[model samples]
Target: MISKTTIDQVYETARLEEVIGDFVQLKKSGSNFKGLSPFSDERTPSFMVSPVKQIWKDFSSGKGGNVVAFLMEHEHFTYPEAIRYLAKKYNIEIEETEQSDEQKEQANERESMYLVSEYARKYFSEILWESEPGKAIGLTYFKERGFTDDTIRKFGLGYGLDQWDAFTQTALDKGYQLEFLEKTGLTIVKEQTTGEPRKFDRFKGRVLFPIHSMSGRVLGFGGRILTNDKKAAKYLNSPESEIYHKSKVLYGIYFAKQAIAKEDNCYLVEGYTDVIQMYQRGVENVVASSGTALTPEQIRLINRLTKNITVLFDGDAAGLRASLRGIDLILEQGMNVKVCTFPEGEDPDSFSKNNSYEDLVLYLDENAKDFIQFKTSLLAQEAANDPIKRADTVRDIVNSISKIPDRIKKEIYIQECAKIMEISEEVLYDTLAQIDKKGFAEASKKIKQEQKAFEVVKNDQVVEKVDVQYELERKIIEMLLLYGNLKQEFEDLVLKENEEGELVLEPEKIEAKVYEKVYLDLQEDEIELTNTQFRTIYYKLIEDLNEREEFTVNTFIANLNQEMVSEVSSILMEEERYVLHDWERKEIYPKEKGQGIAQLVGETILTLRCNLIKTRIQKLQKGTEGNNGDNSEVLEEIVNYLQLNKLLNAKLNRVLS
Candidate 1:
């Protein structure tokens, strides 16, 4: 368990915007920040961060809470993991007790795999630096690649021993479970007919590169073979475990996320070394596909940090053709892409190794071309002196162009392609229209087929009836959170006999604190919140407001359980997202909460009283109908309750039948 002092320090020191901004690109919007929803695939931003409250809310997903909540939701981290992540990011020393063997056995499967992978990373790094074979081969290979000792250690590059079962035996001897080792692909285990199972290292005789999540947790490793083995694959990755998916993981995202966001662009490469070499050369905003095909999940990872991606291609023309399909996927996500090919026979690793930082950056800037232009020029050369191939080339470029979501950008690219292909814009536009029509037809056919196969039910329109008691309870909590400690003059209603010998409410002015008024009013009527969650929060909120000289939403929420924390955040941030639109600038002024908080509080309590009286009247009416004897008494009680409900509603300016 982390010490309470350290947890509190982490919460105080970690800024919500700064922590979330490391993963999502946040742009300033008035008092808060807005960015694309990381939880959902969105073109516009619906994720909001409020620095004043030290909380964030994803309007799309309806997930809102403090900094710790955001981390847990986004990264799938447990509560302790989130705190430790924040502590590390802010450089706060975390005081934690070591877990015993019993406690370790109780950990969940995914967490166990993560622990095993992390342990493997440390063990491999030690071997690379300490063991003779590792020093002779793995360390020497990294050194020859021009990687410094700091870089090697920074990435946690390590070596897997050549002997079978060397790593497996060491891990088992240390009490690390063999089940997790097999799950994380650290040790390969095969069941045997004999009493003992056969086991060996998965990355034996290979140099290891640990892959990390966005928060720097070790997910798995990528290994490269050192010696010649024609039968074996050149490179191997950790198997598809619960924690690591190769297609979704980038090579160096954990290291490059900050630089990518800062530069507002990401450099895309094809291998782990390409990323390391470029980063080691001072070009820090670079990541790789890890020798796999580009995936939408991977593209989204980069999209969170930057919209512009500059794909660094080697001089292999055949490989370039194979990579072009991935560029269309990027365009489909509404990202800007550019292509930069190195000189003949040079890749990102070889080129960066040979050039200085300045020269490398200059070379990239000079050679980077728009994806459309690169695709057009490269294909047009192959279509030379052939009209049929030329027509196919035109359609292919248009197809790529149509994948873009923005209509204006599409039109602009069409005109640009027209000029380059020496064809009129009309021809390209015609081809694009035909392609769109075919796509729409195919989509409609699929929808029709699905509808025919399954029975489709359409829901009737629901008439939304307001929940009077629930809303009143929620409003009471909101007011207490917002203005409970403030002192104000209130119009106190006193029920007294009027000149006509009837009960009437007469207004009397009195000065009192907001919480005091609410508490006294509820006590006088003995009204309690009907909603369970609201009732729990109501008492705690009042207690905190009464005791503390100062109140902050973040601190108040910190004391509540996870469920209450989410409720408080939702109540507080309900109207905050609308601020992103700047309604005042559009000539629509909203009523300020600060101006009439006292009236709002009184009206809320009045509404609650009216609802309770109505409920009493309902119960009296039902009792009178159900009973045959002494019905007159119940009728009189119902009449009195109706009169009180009418009087309260009148004061609230509510029209009732």
Candidate 2:
């Protein structure tokens, strides 16, 4: 465990822009840096990083948080890993309080897997650099691939020994459990005829490539065989595990993310070496599909950085007819895809090796073909003088175009396709509209089917409906975070029962801090938030404010667990999202909470109380149905609740009751 002092030092030293800038190209926009969202596809810059507030928000994805929170979301890193990453980046020394045996035993499943995977990455990197067999095989293979020593180290390339149990033995000796080793697919466990099971290295004898999450934590490894044994598979990847899901990960996203964001273009390739060689040659914005058929999740990963993807293929690798079979997914994601083919008899690795960096880059720029033209040219060659095949090829091209989400892009592609295939533009548009209508109908049908599948079952007794005040509850915490320490004087609008037993609002001057008033109001009414997470935050806020003379968002967040931090961030940023749009710029006076801090806090609590009374009145009404006794008392109670609800709503300036 890292010491609290060390974590705090790292947090204070790590600038939000400086940290996020490594993975995103940020241009100064007023007081903040704006870039294309690292979490979604877009042409305009919607991702904002504010050094003043020490937070970032991706308007597209609706994810906003502080530095550590960004890392956790972006990299799928555990809390400790995120802290350590920041500590390393900012050059802060980390001090640890070592965990005991009991603490180790109590560690969660995800943390254990991360620990084992990180250990394996270090172990493999060590073997590649130090061990003789590793040098003769893994290091030699990497060098021969034209990767420099620094590049290999930067990417964390490594070697897994040929020995059957070398890694397995080292891990167990280091106090790592055999179960985790097996779960990470680092150790292959085999059952014997009699006695304990035998274990061996899964990546034994293969050169290793550690696949990283966007924030640069090792999630899994991909190993390539040095020997082309006919009976064995050429490449063996880590099997599915809790820590790594291949579909959600790109091979070199962590390395290429910033480049992709800066260049506003992503180069898609088929293998790890393709990305490595291109990156080595200065085309840093490239990632591989890792030989798996590209899943929607994979396309979406690339989609986050840029909408433009230039897929590079060696001459023979272009089974253009077959390649187009998978490209519909990219179009569906609204990516502007272009195809670039290398010289005949050459892959990206060999081509880059054979040509100078200048020539290689110039050739890619000149040869890149928009998808419509690329598909038309390739299929036209195969369709040579055959009208039927030509018609079918045009349909295929139009089909891909129809999947495009941008209407303007679709229209442009329609024009290009019509020009290339000599088909009428009207016909293409008609076909596109038909496809879109059918798609909408199918989607609607699916939603209906899903809705039908959702059924609620209850006991014979009445089901007590939970009438929640989430918005008001959220407002209460928001005010606590924003203005809890600020003092305010206001006319007390507390409703009271006079001697005649009539409810009336008695306005009187009362002065108190926001937190004090909120605490007293809730305590007086004995009201608590019904939502579990909000309730927890509410209590923590009161305790902290009570102990200190001041309240700040940073102070409030520091005490929360990761889950609670995310919850608070969501509530705080939900309003910030609107503010970020500059509604005030449009001749609109956006309601500033600071203007009516006292009123906001009181109204929030009053609204919650009013809602609770409404719920009770509803229950009483349910009770009254079939009740033959004491109708006058129930009527009076309902009227009183209604009057309270009306008074609360009036205080909020709400016109609707």
Candidate 3:
């Protein structure tokens, strides 16, 4: 267990914005920061971060919590893992007591797989640096590729020995489970005809590249065989397991995130060497697809750090054709994409090796082309001779343009296409509109099918009830947030009269405070707001009001979690969007809506408190007038009720006036 002191230090030192900004590109939105949702695909940003409140919320997914919660959700880290990660990021030392064997045995299988993968990574890296075979094979292979010692170590490159069962035997000796080894594809298990277990090393005689998840957990490995064995595959990758999914994983992203964000663009390449070579040459903002076609999931991963992607492809014709589909996928995500090809007979690895860092940077800058223009020009030359092919090429480019989610970007690309193809803009626009209509129709059909399926499992009445409650809660919360601090004067009773004739009633001055009354009334019912955003804001308001200080809207809003701030802001402003016509505007003064909202909120609070006081007064009067109880305590209670009622009435009257 980590010491509580160290956990507190980590939480205190880890700034919410700094921690989250490492994953998402956030731009200032009012007092908070807003960015595209990492959990969902959307063009407009719905993810918010509040530095002041130390929390984040994704409006799209309805997931919002403190910084620790974000890491737990996004990175799939356990509570302790999230804490330890934050500690490492903030440079805090973790003090942990050792776990007993029984406790270790109870750990989950996924965690065990993670432990085994980490152990394997360390073992391979050690072999590469410390053993003779590793030095001669793995070290030499990287050195031959022009990789420096620092680059080799930074990427955790390693070599597996040529001897079969060498890794498996060593792992078994070290108490790591053979089951995990087989499950992670590090060891191969062959079941005999007799149903016996037989184990052997999976990547024997190959150099190993450990693939890591975004949180720095090793999930799988990619191995490259050095020997010329025509029967064997040159490179073998770990199969999909419980943790690693190749389509969603981008190699070097764990290390490239900061540079990508800082530069506001990512340079995408094909292989591990490409990333290493670019990084070593001072172009640090680069990652690889790991020799796979780019996936929407992979593009979304890059989307988290930056909106701009520049794909670096080799000059080989096959390479260019193979990569164009991936560029189309990038365009489909509403991202800014540029394509750059190295000079003929070169790839990113070879080109960077042949030039200085400054020269490489300049070469990429000068050669980068926008996706539309690049695709158009590349295909136009081939289609020049045949009319059918020319029309088909135009349609192909239009299809790629149609994939864009943003209409403005599509329009801009359409105009550019017009200029490049020497065609009228009207024709292109008409074709795009038809394509968009077809796309929307197909989408609507899918939505209808989904809705029908959902309706079969849902109860309409229950949904209606929930909707009603949601609206009511939203209205009440809005009022509390907007006018909870407003104050008014009230009348309080002073002194009861002489024993002689009749009781005298004198008015004493009092201040009508809505916040105190509302807070106290809510407390009496013990009713808590069910909505997370509302509940967070409600508790915070109660805390602030209890401090007996004047409430500052800016200060209160500032202290809320980022998700709640955006939500609260949207709720407060959603209904105020319309501008009045001349006659309607004349009858309605500008400040009426503002004052009316405050008065309605204040009056509702006062009324609720007054009703409660009236009920208490009735009980007191009944106790005093009947012979059921002693009158003195009841009389004191009646006196308090009268005082409270007087205050409430005064506030209501002031508001009415």
Candidate 4:
């Protein structure tokens, strides 16, 4: 475990906006900084970072939390991992307690796989730099491709020995598990007739490139073969596994995220070398799909960093034609996409090496075309000779345009395409309408199928029901958050013997005491919140109330898990939005409705507690009336309930008047 002192220091020293600003371009908006939503594609800024509160909210996704929560959400770091990231960023030294061997063995499988991959990366990198064969072959190959030693090391380039089972033997000798090595696809396992495991190197005689997740955890590897053997593939990637999904992983993202966010744009390329060359040429905001056809998952990963993508292609006509489909997928996610092509004889790798950084930048800036215009020009020549091809190409482009989630962007693209293709805007709109109708029909069919499955589960009564007590608990929580500090004068009940020889009520001084009343009432009833989020908030409120300090919503939110933060923020903000709006406009006077709602929420909580208390009191009465009953606990609770009833009456009197 990390020392509490170290954790406190890390949290205290780390500025939320400073940490997040490194990965997002935030413009000041009033007291807060706003940027494009990192969790989704949006032209308008909906992601907000509040420096005063030390939290961020992505209004688009309803995700709001403190600095650690942002790292967990955006970079996919676990709780401890996020803390460690903050520690590293703020230059805090972390001292953790040593774990036993059994404790290490108890770590989660995914984390273990991550550790194994990281170890392999270091081992391969060391071999590449330190070994004679690795330096001569692998390091020389990278240098021949115009890669600097810094660039090579930055990408974790490495080499595997040519001898069979060399890596497997080394890994086993180092106490690494053979099973995980095979599972990660670093070492292949063969089963003989005797059912024994035979392990061998999977990327022997190839230079290695370690693939990393956004948080810098090694997920897999890509290897390039050295020899030109007819049977051997030129490039081999780690097979799909639990930790590494090829379609979702983009090469060089771990390095390019900050640059991409800073520039507010990302350059999409085809290969590893393309990414390296572009970065070396001072275009640092570039990443590669690593030769795979782009997947929606990969696009979403980039979407987290920037809303604009510029795809770079070589001047080879066939490759350009083949890659146009990926651009359509990007547009479907409502992202801005531009296309640029290099000279006929050059790719990004060759062009960047041959030209100065300024020339490359200038060339791209001058040649880049919006997706609509680029697609139109590319398809127009083929369509000129054939009317049928022209109509089909028009439909194809319209289909791509229809995939855009934003209607305004769709219309803009439609106008651009119509003007370029010499077609009427009305015609393009009509065609897009047909495509949308077909898509809606298919989507409706899928929804119906899902609903049928959901109905089966519903019929079985598998869904958990929210009880009345839960609602009451939530209402109480809301009131405590909003009106806990609001004070009012009220009549306090005091017992006295009157002339009639009976107990009588005398008025005494009292304050509203919202937090105290709620806490004492909950304690009297022994009612526990069943909802996890409500329970978390309730306990936190109790802690604050016990200290007699006003509850700070931001402070409470900062300490919660990201998932719980979203849940709590949604509950708090959903109700407050309309209330605050009405108050601001001065359209709704604070009269009966507002006061009545507050009173009702408070009363409902008291009623629930009172009923539960009364039931327990009855049980206690029965047990005491019988034999072997200890009523001390019950007596103490009854006395507490009487005091709570007095307090509740005091609060009710102020509301009633």
| Tens digits of per-residue lDDT for model 3, 168-224 | 899999999888988888999998889767888888999999998776889899999
| Model 1 pairs in collision | none
92 Cα displacement, candidate 1 (Å): 1.8
Best candidate per TM-score, number? Answer: 1
Whichever of 1 and 3 has more TM-score, that candidate is 1
TM-score of each: 0.97, 0.83, 0.78, 0.80
User: Ten-residue segment with the worst summed lDDT in candidate 1?
Assistant: 454-463
Candidate 1 positional error at 386, Å: 1.1
Tens digits of per-residue lDDT for model 4, 1-657: 677677777777888888887666777665667776777766566677767657677777888777888887877666777889899978899989877789677767676677778888888888889999999999999999999988988888899888898888988898888878888898999888897778789888899989887767799999999988889889999999889999989998888989998888999999988999889889999999999999988997787677899999987887677788899899877789999988787899999988999999999899999988888889988788688999998998998898888989888889999888889999999999899999999999999999878535445566587676667777777666655655644443456777987555576755666666667557765777777778888888767656756556665665666787766555554432333234647676444323754355456665675546555667766766756656788678776665555555554453322
Task: Give lDDT tens digits, candidate 2, residues 404-473.
Answer: 8888999999999998888899988888888788889999999999988977455665868754587788
lDDT of 1 at 412: 95
Relative to the true structure, candidate 1 has a C-alpha RMSD (angstroms) of 1.8
lDDT of 1 by residue, 418-455 (tens): 99999999999999999989989999999999889976
Backbone clashes in model 3, listed as residue pairs: none
Can you rank all candidates by lDDT, best first? 1, 2, 3, 4
Off by over 4 Å in 2: 15-76, 437-471, 493-507, 510-512, 520-536, 546-550, 576-590, 605-657
Model 2 lDDT-worst window of ten = 571-580
